[model samples]
Target: MDTSRREFLKGTAWMGAVAMAAGCMSRQSAAAGGASGAPMHGFRVAPMKRVRVGFIGVGARGTPAVKRIAQIPGCEVTAISDVNPARLDAVQAWMKERGLPAPKEWSRNGDKDAWKGLCDSDVCDVVYSATPRPLHCPINVYAMAHGKHVLQEVPGAFSLDECWETVEAAEKYRRHCMMLENCTYGEEEMLAFNLIKKGKLGEIVQAEVGYQHDQRSLQYNPRDGVFWRIDRHMKHHGNYYPTHGLVPAGRCLDVNRGDRFEYLVSMETKSASFEAFGQANFPADDWRHNAKMVKGDINTCLLHTAQGKTLSLIHNVCTPRPYDRGNLFMGTKGIYRSYPSLLMAWEEKVGDGGAHKYFDEAKAQKIKEEYRHPFWKVAGEIAKKVGGHGGMDFVMDLRWAYCLQNGLPLDTDVYDLATYSSIVELSERSVNARSSAIDFPDYTRGGWKTAQPFTVDEIDMSKFGFTS
Candidate 1:
């Protein structure tokens, strides 16, 4: 199973972009969605028949997103593009197995310059952008300007300006732009979000969340190729990856358009390791990668919601601990923690409302019939039956299809992405300036301070005091 020439070239492109030679369009996310030659979201006043999807990266995140999205009812994965030519081999295999058309792939061989143009071709109505963090803004801006909806991977874009440009392009072009923060669809997070929305967590006063999986080994592996994360560590500080942990927590907390997050402070620990173990394990040809990255450690950001609620956010990639998302939410009545037993409270004896009283007789009996995180309420047997990242992945894929089917704004949009990601991009400014409170930019620079929270057919979060 060696890479064919085309595959090798594509892989090289992916590595180049991922390696920072090109700047991140390799590992973030990519997918084929909707149908071909149709309008996505606000393309036209009248609805288009389908949401044709073109995925721009078939590597790690894109592959899975494509695989799962293939299960969507009306979506047609029209095309794919990647720096890693070899990745198409896998895409071809998977598509064949599913009895679908093999999408045309853009590679260096086809035309070194064709990858960017492929995004704007008549073949797709939307582009699922799973490129690296740095490339997000450029690719998204390009796609939106060219009249294509974009579903970018997490953290949306690396810089605040980039975030602004991308979203501005989206609105200007009237294309739907969604930052695919899948963790929000995670069963536990969803359950927590719904519980809070349902008023289960009475008046959330404070919360905690993080992206705390120790990826030290993976991030430095030569076999894993180069990554833009190195650039962040080598040149920056503050919350490294905030969107994954924050989006879900923010959803439950309702930190949106006007319900904004005020300025806060951040503190960091030490760096992981200066030398690349992967480069050390490999040959002199990889010597270019052996260098000291200048990022600080264990990013801990404390935030104060406009409503005076408190939040603790952590982002760490270099640690030797069991995988943990570090989610804990405290309201006037109870609290919720993600790991080490997934639930917490001030003792069930004091239950004013919410999932807290599921233990007490009076409240538990009344709420017995409520709908839980559609997939997570019962993680064992039910999640196993439905499959797909314990069902959150399925939820994400399904919702995209559902939105396309109904012509609605996506569940997670550009504003939500900025709310969560601006923390990382601006935290460095905040920290370097001695924890000076950094003001979040209103990219909507259009009257978004009064914008509405995104909602779906059945999910309404206002009941829990999110109206603030």
Candidate 2:
């Protein structure tokens, strides 16, 4: 074999060993619960009339999130943090342009941990972070410890230990730590959730979900002579971004509510796409040309729930494909699929006798209108007007603020954050173990059996002085 191929195999073997070691470590600590040995399920705190928001990493995701939060009724952007001073200035200028006061800035001028200052201060009641994946848990744990609730971007924690740390921190500090999983609030996702809730679809038995979109450009594009995302791709070999597809599917199956993920087995195709792309694009001496991307081009993981339901999850970013989450749910009485087109099929007794084929446009529209989530009915127009990922981002931000203002439980809590994000490392262990099954850590500590499933509680915009 050529030198490059031999090195690649060596690296793969090393990663497999590391995954096994991490699994052993995780199992040793799996029994530990929160600091107080209590679960944070259904946990609530006193209402805040106005939730002061502090933003960390005002880059791609954070900038739009800042804009959306600024528009929410009970939210105020009082503090902002970013390593880049230019981005901080941009947000300050934008706030000034809208006749709002400038937020206090936290930049990496002296201390690299400048964002922590925002968490320590009294300027904000909650901290929202859209920073890199690695910083998510540290920021969240620190924010909660400092008496600030935290809302973090997707994949809330990278490892099982971080997941447990988040759970424990939230329980100890008595502060909220919610993962900002916007897809859960998508129009169709919420519709499916409501359908399942209303029994439109009988007991959901299986689901297929995925995050499949070509991200070669984003991963390979040089930013400061560093391929941050691609570098991680070269190092890890698992479903790094599983929550996008898993959260919605898990919710539809009532995961971490009445049912919980028990074990999962994962497999992946060879890592060829990135090397091929680099060979065609970069020079011989460029790091990309010689980098052996360890992460597979396509990864498929099969997860089994405690209640015997199954979920098939796919993750692929290196291929040429249209964006799709593979939001397909199958139940005893009906089925819903949302890709390429929105379609549904119901048994004769459940619907108008179209079990053999998907509903046409008219029937599909009728069913959608009938089972449309209450959230969309109230905030859909304004959400569309604000526009992020077709209004789901706005709805998510609005719901987070609404719950905080009312002292109600968030739609997605610390347990959801931990459970959904845990798939990242769990899948890696399975993949490295040659598709062996890996059991999930019970982050909820047995609270899931009785925890109430998520409900579509409509927000009364008028109560917050909005006429919609």
Candidate 3:
């Protein structure tokens, strides 16, 4: 091996907690809640007009996100920052081709920290960051400190310390700091959430959610100018990307609403596929072939809620398998599972043998349509047209714009970001301790006791000049 196994294992021991704490200790006090006539805990912009947006990290995710934001009526891409000048130039060229004015560009200018200039600039009302995991907290804190609301990518923080910093920064700035967890807005997932909210699930007992995609090609490819994801896989051994599944699952379970995640334990199978790929793709003598990998091929984490409910979350990226988010909810009266959805319920009907059975396709479709989330029913068409992750991503962007325009609190708040992303750090602690239970932090500061449960409230279309 290029490095001793002990050296590789030693890398995981450092939490960077002290550095994070010292950095946050000097930050200004949390921002006060909104003034009268403003939405709760929201900072309202005067005479709300088109929201000016600044984007950082315009690579694969940010490129498409900027395009989707440009399609929204009340959102304008005002500024962009990227370490890759080619990406910035490409996006500017695309805007010009589409007859939209080019945005101000913030280049790295020999400083790897150039994103800070974009965050500190006055050109944008909302700062959207799609940077790698390590940079999420720093960029967001800087953005909020500069009085800009933030729409950041998923798994917003990599460690508990970073999560705390995010929560404190958002509260202190009194500005919106929403994680862009698009899965929560997926058409089917939103419908499931609506059913859960209406008590159709009849007290969810256990739920299973996962990011089970076999996209090793993306993970192994280093030519795209960013190997951060690959680097994370090399250095960590826990559920790294938890938000895609955890956020929606948490919302359905009403995490941090009526219930909060109490504690979690995780276990993993030995790593194989990544090691095999390195041997086959790289030179035999190359260090890549011998680099020590700590990540498990598949990781399973079980989390219990304060109400005694459980959430089963799995993460698998190295294996060859079909793409599946593993959205499954088992309730007292019924159950729902997706990837071409299937529903079985005691309420639907009984089988000829006098047993509860699966609902017929037609009946199930009718029920889903009936309970279909209002947001999807009203805006699903536009979302499809705008088109990101089968419209869910676009819907998320438009909703962020709508909330900002109307001065309403966001769908996924700062606490949600911290709690869901906490799984990353917490799962690491659990796995390293031989699957010992790790307690979840109550980022809400005891507010979960009375916080309102998740809702499927549609955006106020009229505010965005839409007449749905």
Candidate 4:
């Protein structure tokens, strides 16, 4: 193995042990009662006229997020940290080009913990991290502990203990900790959410969601030099990337609000597709050919909610196939499915037996326009112009800034982060235990019962000069 791979394995082994110990302690605390800290449901802070933001790991995701946040009216990128100084320089230059002040840099310079300095500094009101998976929890906890709100990449926690740690930290610190689940901000997803809120789907009974993108080339690209994603596939099993689909699905069902996931059962197919891809693409002597891919080619996890709702979550990164999020929602009076295309069917009357067919294209378009989310209605054009992941990234960042600027409770709070991220470890446990059902921790301490459902309130685009 290469030196970096050897060091990564060693570090991963140590982290696994630490995670287990932490998990045991957290469970013990839960058994006694609950976390010592208060719950962060509907938590809000004083409004900031300009929310100063610090960024860590300004690579692919962070770079675009920084640019988008710069365009937002109430956000100021104050600091950026990364191991690569070149990335910092590039971002600084971009800021200069945009006539924005260059952010202070916290480059590695032989210290891998350089990002901690950014979190500790008082320059930023919030810290956003697009770091590797292992660093997500640590950055979140540390940033919140230091009195800065945190915005982290998807699957915020790698293990159950990390999930608990983030929740406790946010609660104890009284700061917003939100997972940057951009998928929830997608135009289609927002439209679906609006329809659900408007009773178009009736009572949602089940949701089918999954991340099924073929990432063989990205994972094993020679030019990229071995991504950490492929390393995850080698080391772990069961839904390593779940939030892309789960967050949007959960939002439709009011997860961690009116309902919470109760238990999960997961199963996986044999691991062969990744290895086969490596063999077919790379040389016989390449590291990919020799690496052992332990994770299954596909993992499907079913979750039961406290309200008796069901969710089907799937994860598959290997195999050559068309990209799909597998977003399908089944309801008592209607159904919405988006894979090959957007499809919906609903009954005009309860049990009238007229909901057997989907709406035609023209009708569907009209309904979509009528029920379009307010955020899209106001900022859709600007979002489309800025553009990232079909403008969802911009919407997500814009909403983050708007909430902070207005002192509104975040659409997705700490509990959502904990509940959604806990799937990574929870699914792994179920898979390793021969598909045995594993109970989900009530990270909200039963607060979900009274939490309000997410709403699609319209923003005044004129305030940001986006519309008149």
- Model 4 alpha-carbon drift over 4 Å, by segment: 1-26, 30-35, 108-110, 222-226, 462-468
lDDT of 4 by residue, 217-259 (tens): 8888733353788888888888889999899999999888888
TM-score of each: 0.79, 0.91, 0.87, 0.92
Per-residue lDDT tens digits of candidate 3, residues 194-271?
A: 888887666789999999887677877755646788788888889999888778889998888889999999999999
Each model's backbone clash number: 24, 0, 2, 0
Highest TM-score model number: 4
Q: How accurate is candidate 2 locally (lDDT)?
A: 0.83
Candidate lDDT values, in order:
0.64, 0.83, 0.78, 0.83
Error of 3 at 203 (Å): 0.9
Candidate 4, residue 184: how far the Cα is off, in Å: 0.4
Clashing pairs in 3: 30-172, 31-172
TM-score of 1: 0.79
Task: Rank by TM-score, highest first.
Answer: 4, 2, 3, 1
Q: Candidate 4: minimum summed lDDT over ten consecutive residues — where? A: 13-22
RMSD of each: 11.0, 12.5, 12.1, 10.5
TM-score of 4: 0.92
| Candidate 2, 1-468: lDDT as tens digits | 544234322344223322332122354444554235457888888878789999988988898888777756567999999887777887887788777788888974735599999999999999999988889999989999999999999899899889878887898889999999999999999988988888867899999999998998788884434466677788998998998878988888888899999999999999988888888888999877776888899999999999999999999999987999989999988889888678898885865565688889899989899888998987776676667888899889888888888888888889899988888898899999999999988877788999988666788654442222
Model 2 segments more than 4 A misplaced = 1-34, 108-110, 222-226, 350-353, 465-468
